[model samples]
Target: MFLLSQAQMAKNGKTSPRPRNNVVYQDGCFFIVDFLRFSVPQTTLCSLCPGEEFVRLTITMAATGPAHSTAADSTSASIAPSAVVAKPCHNCRRRRLRCDRSLPSCQKCIKKGEKCLGYGKLLVWNRGVASRGKMMGKSFHVPDQAAASTAASGNQELCLPRKYRFVPSNMPDGEAEAEAEAEASGDEGETSVSINPCLVDPLFQDLDRASRFYISHFTDQMCRDLITYDVPRHNPYRGIVPLIRDHALLLHVIVANSAIHISNVISKGSGLLNGVPGQYPQHDALMAKQKTLQLLNQAMNDIDAVDPEVVLTAILLSINYELVSSGKDDWKVHVEGAQKLIDYFGLSKRSDLSSAMSALRDHVVSDCLIYYILGSTFSARQPNMGSMTSRYPFLDVLPLLERAEANSYMSCPAFLLQIMLSASHLSNLDVITGFEEEQAGYLMERARTFNIDAWAASVQGISSHNDFESRVHVASAHKSAVCLYIHQAVPSANLMDDDNRKRIVEDIIGHLSFILPGNLLLKGTSWPTFIAGAESRDPAQRAWIVARLNDLWEMLPWGYVHTAIEMLKAVWAMEDTAAETTGGWLKKLKGLGNDWIVV
Candidate 1:
């Protein structure tokens, strides 16, 4: 199978201006370049054959030109012998649109009357629109304050400006990644290389060769992405790799999630949409999820027959699948399932890792609480879902969470997490009974005034100016957001002054600027960004929100952030057309349903 990709080709210390007929190899990837600007041969559409090796690591290059072979045009043949099969072009991939793969440009762009950026070049529109949102684009001028803050943060140089977004990021520094991006002001377009080889791993035996692609993808790529603040060689997921040797159930969970993750990345990064077809072997995400459920059922039927940790991990992975697969209404259902297992297994109370168990549970307590609280921000599947309630109360388990446990997953300080959880619990109580103005005031004061300097002083290993600045910015962002949540949730507290609210919004946006998109901290900012986005009134500010969320989408490559972007646009639309009907984010979020876990 051939792939469509591009790289910044450098020759004699200058970026190449035209395509040349030759083959170039760098890193572990190979590119076939030619002068066939258009008139690509009609390749036979060979649909994925059912359940074969899926993929084998054998790449043979057959050169093609004006006199290559007449037999190449035969339709009955599997694929044109000389044509390299193509993936989506740059424009098609960015817009998540189907490309006809016609040479110099895609027919899809021609039909849409838009410029087709070639397979490899990174380009943009003057005033581009998002693939999913109906919101129209206007010329966006970045706020001076925001631009200055972004420049101060040091990621301004790495920024790849976009007229529109929901674009993916390329961050590979001695780690597992598929794509690499580079740019130089005058004369610095280096010969960038990407080592994206989808070869099977021997560690993943006893599965279809194609299925192993997803398994390997998870272990090598997504697993590291989960740990936002740091990349440790012995990161928790790697600890679980050897466990797959004896447990067939765990492998199914990995495949289900990984395929769905790939699917999410392609489909405009939206869980509400379907995975774009033919990028990889035909592994239906939904079907894989169903198979996972069946395996889970069989394991559940035999009491104490399956390791509880495995069962819990499987349940959590299902929750993950729901997050990327439609923002599925079952988000809370799986969280609830995890709760039941935690109750039965006492995982909430258990902190001892002295004994060997599945590596899945290592950092789960903090992760579970993070998802539980953050999920409450946008869940609209049910009505009056203001209170972040779980059957067992993920909040109460927070005190028991060790700093290492909390730090292992999320990037913010543990103290701030507790404050956010406590504030959410107050919101929950307001929904249950009457609002307690005094209690909410106390929480908001602490949330808004917590000293980041003091907090940093108390913590260990927070070295480097960049890392410290990222933590401080993210901590303050969360502070502003949680305060806004309290103001919305407990209106009786009288913190809803319009000027104060807008100031908080500005602060939240500014903090976001300090935290670069590629920094792990950006992954944690979506909740705050969405909270601020729904409350924002200016179109330009809203445009900035879209750009940052787009950066976020590039980093995480999950539907959760895309879902936030869409939801924010919906809120903006409501305000623009019917100003009186807007009820801030909490009311609008509850209207969306209580099941969305956009983490």
Candidate 2:
């Protein structure tokens, strides 16, 4: 009966199983029950003294309730599966903070009883506040000090340069370092038309020192490559072999300066031809081989020992090889050389070497004019479309021309004519080589607009003494037209203006008048021989120049026409002056009869 009563009590949640007859009671998640242990009290009257102790409680089921319960309670309750427990601060979350349920850090956690927990979101807010505080300090306080600290901090992590301390390489020795310095410091403007400040004013670096500096900077291998190879890829030029010749000329200057031993060794291998060793060779074959070596040696020697001005002059003389083509056969060779010269002289990008030639100011104009000659001429004779410039690419001289325009260089009719000739050459080469008809036509049209051929045709009438003045007048008038037309065509683009045009033509006229008689024409030289020589030497160029002169004359004002006629009459009457003059003059004059052949 007692067992049945106990079972009913257990079912009614009144009792739970106890081990070793120990009674248990309930706490929240724990149970505490007490059973009597009989012991004699001090009075020895009580069978069991009143006592309490904790015992294990067995829970059959748990019911939900709020988590903040205090003092153990036994009741029917359950926890919903969806209920969430609040989290603590960030640091606390990572450290699993023990919550004191305070604002930021719990008091217990703050007190080091455990990590105090606040809401993780509140921790983020505190960090933002701290960052703001730091920013305020930075802004209101020592800015330089803060910057220095920042820079110092950055220095610790990065390998940034503090100053320009150049440590040159030891191996493969040469003036490479010097060259680099020159490249860094040298005016990028030096080129064919550039006037060297040193040459003109001497305030610039000494020309001799500068040249030596450059020579030393280039390595032996680099010098050799420039001197020996770098020939035009095209065939006829490859055959004529002007590339090495031009290089040899430059080397001659260096050798003449006694700056390099290498040039002497190479010059010995170049055998003497029909001409004297030092003189300019007349024959093409000799020019390509022997004369090339001679010029190079001379140039080198000049650079080594001569006056810096002389050296500068030598440099110009040697570089002129880039200007002259290998006749009509290997025109591409000259064109390529010019392009390379522009690159070599640091004029490849459209900019002035000096503010000397307004024509050169237009980089696109210059390049378009110059590069096309190479691009076109190299492909001139080729039958295969694949080998031609037109097939593979189109030249863009416009940009260079535009650059010249910016620098006030596109002012000369002669300059414009050069550009036109280049275009025409490209067009003719394309047509001759059977390139696309459309491209050829386009190039032809471009050529006609510049009126280069007309100018060339015009210049033929003027004789040597008056060629200069006559050439200038014709070039000025025609150039004016060109500038006007170009401006009309491209109104927004700054083509050459009237003032610039006049300045350039006047400059050319002044230069020609100064140089032609003193330098080119002498008292006894044959007019026909002179004419023939000039024409044969540079048929294309001479033709073009002559044409420009003719155009200038045609466009001359009425007063100039009468002056030109008087000048012609004077040339015709030279014989009368010779007869009337002294014996010495007569002897000089006698040579004039041999100068011309009526046929």
Candidate 3:
């Protein structure tokens, strides 16, 4: 918290020879002064300086001797037994000004006939005090009722109150009540104080309580330094491959989430100002946001330097959040960043070795998820900004899927569904344009790397009642439909004759119809908005719209059965009508299964 100005602390207020013993190098304005021990106020100000006053600078070059001491180690008088009963400043309480710790009665408190509150002790960190002038003492313990209520509240405001200012008037009564309950429960002492006490305040409570002592003493900038510069620079995880494998990705996720939270707070300025009844500083939130970004950037560099997996995860996380937040502008950059790792490690080609690396599966899964996210984003309509990137057709996505299939252990249904949807958007006439013998041979070679027979065999092991296998089959069929559509879109493509293309589309529709029954309909459909908003007030309609998903599954040996069912469901629910528009999907779901039990 110290802002040092060595030049100003000197005799001539010039940056010159360092001041020697007995000289008090004090120039900056002092806000809070925490002496090593208790004593009277001892702030020194240079008479010549006016604007320089109030700066929280340290006396870096103050001279010292036996009688005089370095400011860093200036000792305080021992607290007598009677000093335990600290008094509050009457004037500060009456005026609602935060009081500087003074003796039995502070100057303002005495003048105002107010109680002078003495701080028990300052909360220190590591082995030192956090801020200068903070009283060091043991913190008061709260009762069980208070602790349980606070824990049950779920909101961090109960614990981190200082970080927020409660705008009770704007907030609902229940929320304000919870905050009040949390504070009242924590405050065991029934003292008649003028204003609410921050001592028992959950926000400024000791770091030791939370075991966050490491960064407790740190200012916003110092926290930036400790994690961004110090922690990574130390290479704490260097050579610990197992630890990195087990926890590194998770740790990085926490860091990214924390940074996002900080950025949200700063950008929104939601809880930074409120019911405190005075002007509070907003600069800290802004600074904390900047520092968090810097930390994120640093963490990203560290992950990239040490491991490719972490980098891939970070990129995917950024993409995931962007998709959630509708931050489409930065989508491609993140995608390219992920693509770099896939290229670097040659992860596009699945390795055949029996003993693979520890995170091999994870790396494959991450890529699959990334592709799925991007593909979904491409298909989902923008809120108001129109379509995002659609120039790349379903044909172009096949290579990416083929690459993912080669790398992944299982034929993930979600990824396959993405490809299928993309395919459905195109025509079926281009299926055979590029079916050269060599390229066709490549497909067969890669397909051998797949274990379709084993996958099918594994499906029978599950109970007949279970639909996991059916779901996977349906999803894979959907993917096949996508491939068929892509083939038809190419001018020269023709995997199937004109009649066969029609058959493929019909087969896809059949498959869609099979799964539109009972719970399975809602379970499998790829309609984003409806599925995403299923938890809303009306969910029964989703089931009503498609009540024959199981029948569609039985009908479609080819592939279009599923597509047909989807079209039927769309028509049944009125989701396909021009008047319905794209936004009516959720409403349709609500209206679908209003009567019969979807089970």
Candidate 4:
């Protein structure tokens, strides 16, 4: 047997030269032939020597391993070899071999005839290399995954965060998910109108912050003005935040309203109108309103594609926008639009009142009634629904009035609707001439005979209940105002003496204090205050009414409030100059062509 060092064999040209200081040599009567030089296969090299020689060579090779590459040694210098480094498979680590660290398996194990141990401590790149564009030589577009998903699904409005998604109270989880998926895929045969991407993208980009702002304002501030009664179930703005996220148009309306509200608050605090700071820009709000109007027109034109909730919310928000910002009578157009939607849905005809009338419908109808009544009160024309009894024969106004007299919150609005209906008819009477004047006399007689004292007495029982107090106070105040309206409409009638009329006006002024200045119920007392202010003969009472009007203007800043205040001021000026009655003030107001509707 002959032993050859790798260097000696290489010098003799028997082996190819390499760093082989650690290579092993065994006993062999061997021909000093290199496998690479002689073209001998590796498998045959062991057989060329005897079995004992091969076994001895294997033992020697195990003792003195092959030389390590400088690259691997330097790269792994930071980590101890036995420290169980991550990223490499267990098999590769155990064999002290390099690992490619590919997922599932590595290449080192397969080449070495060993089973591949799976990867260890997988590390994910959250912000991929593409996000660090500076590291790359050229810029590449990493498309927004959310935008792409919304585009593919064709439901840009549905890309809200989970926290903002409002699941309806009645919707099942499975059905809701199915519906969402269907909506995302546009499977309901709904009309697909492509809104301007510019109008939608920026809103969605800041949706989280915008949603929080609007929802906070709605719950804390807006609800105070919206829900005057204790009928929580019938309040339309309840649980409307999530709905705002579901529809783009509704979201715009809410944001627009929120912008106006923020502006008002800032204006009140700083006494600066243009420099008010807020997340929603004033221009954005104005643009949103314009967009909302455009979308509303489209929805109205495409009747089949109109979403009832969207239309209803849009109309309500538009009305509020007009009240907060424009303070114009453009809100009447929205009221009429809401009426068209209500009629389209046949909400009044549905048999199951609870199931058929959603909170949105209740809000729409109530708002329409309030606006229609106010508009008819001052306008020269009358509404088509002449009387509550004639318009809704099924709805018994007598029971509703009795229930209201019992201080039932649910019945108060219905009762008020009845009063407004009758007032609407009597308001149009040509009392200057004798045209249908007897009908006015009959309405005045009914109003005088109505037991308002009983209703006021019923509120006394519930006045102690904190939850019910505000609503009761507002109801009583509105009832007093209605009585004052009846007197003002037919002051010449002998149903009540001059003393009784003065007592009614004093009662209205007294009731107005309960919901004046800071109270949310003050929103519903504007018209009543106007009526009482016009009739107030005493300087102290007239000053108090004017102060309340000023407070309302300071808080809401609506144009109508300003108009009402101006009209009241003119009436007060006339009364100071001469003893002007409520009818005389009305005549002066009519002569000025100022058909002021205060509510």
Candidate 5:
């Protein structure tokens, strides 16, 4: 047996004169290749790998028969006895894959669904995960001064980054690759419109085209849709996106949300999931949701060590994913997980978080408060939907509401939320005893006299007449719904008389209808809309509620919207058929067999 490394072949693959020290070949000779590959028979090596290849050991041939093999021996042996240099592409070299030296990109990378970093591109790998100080396993991207000063959290109206100038590559093999990448990364603003498959950050460059689309869609549009009333620059959801992308759990949740939403848009809100308990109607959304759930379940096993913000964000996103599916996508499961996390660890009391995290914290607190209180109001009598948020003294949200009023993305005003929180807290009690009555009465009085116009005017950035009107419409709708919840729910001095309740329900529908479909504030009205729909007694008002909800569905297209609409229809049918049908929203909601967030 003779060992032959292809290194001994000439650059041109022509037969070379035997070196003095080279071993002479013998009968039945076999060749062993030593470039991290197994041995091959001499006949098979020349026949199988027809093209020139680089090997790392000496090659000795059968000199005893016919002196030495030459190019004249066989057509397949043309490259065997000669020396030719072979250069592998960058990806092939790193992965030790055989390369055909394909131009621009390798076939293996294409087949493996990888973005082939072609030859001539320098690569610097992370050295040992950088365990120096707190920077260990952490990286940060600092935004510009304008974004830094705009708000405490989120990627506020970020200035358009400098476009990647398409330099005509002068390198021999990388020119095509440079052009391909530059073309795939369209302008930042066009992500939503164009659905650019390559719109990915350098941090997550390995993601496939579909993942890139979902991530881009979340950053470009979903962030804005989620918040109550913030311009794109000041959107709080943007603040945590960098955090989400790095977290596999969060990224999967975000992508699932975007996927469901995009599906809804594409389907034009058809195929309504009137009621679903098990497998989701949409396949991709369900698979994505299952992945996130699996990751989250693994996370929950060590519940005490998980961050409260992570739990809150996951619950928020999972809720979003459920809302878009129009079925029971297991939102309560996520919330139950969050409740356990809160029960075990408790939210951090320290106020020294980074500005972005602080901003994210406030927004999450506001959203959590809204969802928990709304859930509390609608749920069967219990403080069960959420735990950490309910732990806050109800009255403290008064200051929180006032501060968020001017420039925050809170759907229900802080005062109204404080009232909702207090009302939820009071109503969740075993019974509304005398002491609870005092607190309920105070909240009811405050809600009764809330001047939405004055509150709208107090908002800092409302300069245009249309803007003020939009704010008032949104605030008034939430206020009316909140008031109805308080008067009927909390054992106040004066419970809602049927006449007053009718007026409030009508007020909610009226104010909501005035906001129109194009308004951003309208997106935050789902809870209020549900309350008004569920509370209405008038037939004509119910019909209008149906039509109005259809309009909201057009804009929001959320799973809960259809579910709420169906529930309202059922409630209307129940009211029409039963002789003794008078009941509050919670009494009506009892025995529903599920806990879901209305907001």
Candidate 6:
């Protein structure tokens, strides 16, 4: 390799206008300079562009000088033949510092406490000086002393180093000759690097196809359910595609999700519930998943390697992957990992990132809140909602929610989530009897009358489009679910009649029916649907709930959904056996330690 600098090119007048035909541009421009001969007849080519500078090259040379030399006289001319070498150790080269080339190890690396990456064989230009002469429109030949010496000594190893040796494999003679000719006529002294023919074409071609598939299908197809309401003028996943492309970890996660989703569709079409046994291998998907996990683990450990956007993308993709694949709860691990990263970066403490990142930050925080509420509500546990709201001050703050509403796509309604969290806290309190129970009943009554219509109207005022309308439906469903949960917490015989409870369940089911059919709001509806299903005494209504869940499972089959289905069945069975009301069944279900949360 030859190192060229823009300052050197400027000093040598290499940037001056020249004949355009003389300059060759492959991926970029290449300037062919004249050969400068030494005792060794080696040729090297260096390319540089004037407008786009900052190019450095590495060239390997044979050792030729004594070992000991002063720093001032370390140049090629001052060093003895045995001391001067072509390339420095890898560590020194990376640091752009001089190397005192030594066998097995380098002194510079040892002094700096770095591992010395060993030197490899030197790459000699096979065409020699004749190729340079041909480029210059002249006839010249340089005898190959190395080849002649090897032939004379009957030692093939002396002709070329093992690392630089190349042998063609499985190619027709005509094709091999044509390839050789092409290499010869290409840029002079530039080595041709080839990969394994069998591996290169298929692997890279599949990667290209997968990348295109993700770009075209992933955002619209997979993300539509997650983000039901469209932002003002932005595609949520589109803005992050470039970031995913630039990050290996994030890209791997996306590729994994894409491959798994495709595999699932193919499996379903082929009458394979899981996958073909020892046939129709999912190598790409499996490899991508494995690599993503490896890289994600590595990234999590390295502070400098982890970025908030990258972590958030990986979390979302991992969640998507979990939903589509065989039901698994590993997505919770990813969510927890994202929470750790958010805390590490102090993303929840302040909104000081760039506008784009701030939007992402809001979305991430919203997702966290949604999951937290779902977990607490479904499991009959209370989360530290106050702490969460304190960390992310915008969770309950109306002004910040309205300000960010236009930019945050796929985010849960902050006001509704806060109400649900408050209800969950009240549910977890020990207010079953006496003065505390009376006070709690009063508070629950106040919560039930919280003016949801006014809130919905305020949100609708922001945008009256279909997207906002969908959000209004989701908010109403969640508010109904929160009320149901609060009532379930205080199991009073006469607080609400059986007809009144049935009405509440019907209202929630009606609100959810608007968006749940399309699976548009599945991520935020699990808790609501569970509560509604648990409360519904009508066989037809229960069947409808089961059917809707089954449909949702077919769309996004997360492990938690399967668990929720099993728990719902248990609740229904207990109600049948004990002839108990929905509230009594829920109390017994909670006692049985069957708390599974889905979001």
lDDT of 4 by residue, 282-301 (tens): 55568678888888888888
Candidate 1 overall lDDT versus native: 0.58
Q: lDDT per residue, candidate 5, 509-538, as tens digits?
A: 878878777776767777788788777877
**Residue by residue across 91-179, what tens digits does model 3's lDDT show?**
56556776643433344555576544433333435332222334233233333566556656663322332233333233457866886
Per-model TM values vs. the true structure: 0.60, 0.23, 0.34, 0.56, 0.60, 0.55
Pitting candidate 2 against candidate 3, the one with the higher TM-score is: 3
Model 3 alpha-carbon drift over 4 Å, by segment: 1-178, 181-252, 255-296, 299-304, 326-329, 345-454, 458-468, 487-599
Best by lDDT: 5
Rank by lDDT, highest first.
5, 1, 6, 4, 3, 2
Candidate with more favorable, higher lDDT: 2 or 5: 5
Which stretches in model 2 have alpha-carbon errors above 4 Å?
A: 1-319, 322-334, 337-347, 350-599
Where model 6 places Cα greater than 4 Å from the true spot, the runs are 1-208, 211-216, 230-233, 263-287, 326-328, 380-412, 426-443, 461-464, 467-473, 490-497, 513-526, 550-563, 579-595
lDDT per residue, candidate 6, 407-468, as tens digits?
34323455555656655554565545564456446645765676655655665666434455
Q: How far is 16's C-alpha from truth in model 6 (Å)?
A: 65
User: Which stretches in model 1 have alpha-carbon errors above 4 Å?
Assistant: 1-202, 267-282, 355-360, 381-396, 399-409, 425-435, 458-466, 579-583
Q: What value does the lDDT take at residue 255 in candidate 4? A: 67
- Considering TM-score, which of the candidate structures 5 and 6 is the better prediction for this target? 5
Off by over 4 Å in 4: 1-216, 229-235, 270-275, 278-281, 351-357, 383-413, 431-435, 448-473, 491-498, 514-520, 551-560, 574-583
For residue 191, give model 5's deviation from the true position in Å. 24
Between candidates 2 and 6, the TM-score winner = 6
Worst 10 residues of 2 by lDDT: 40-49
lDDT of each: 0.58, 0.31, 0.36, 0.55, 0.60, 0.56
- Ten contiguous residues minimizing lDDT sum, candidate 1: 162-171
Root-mean-square deviation per candidate: 25.0, 25.5, 22.9, 15.3, 20.0, 23.4
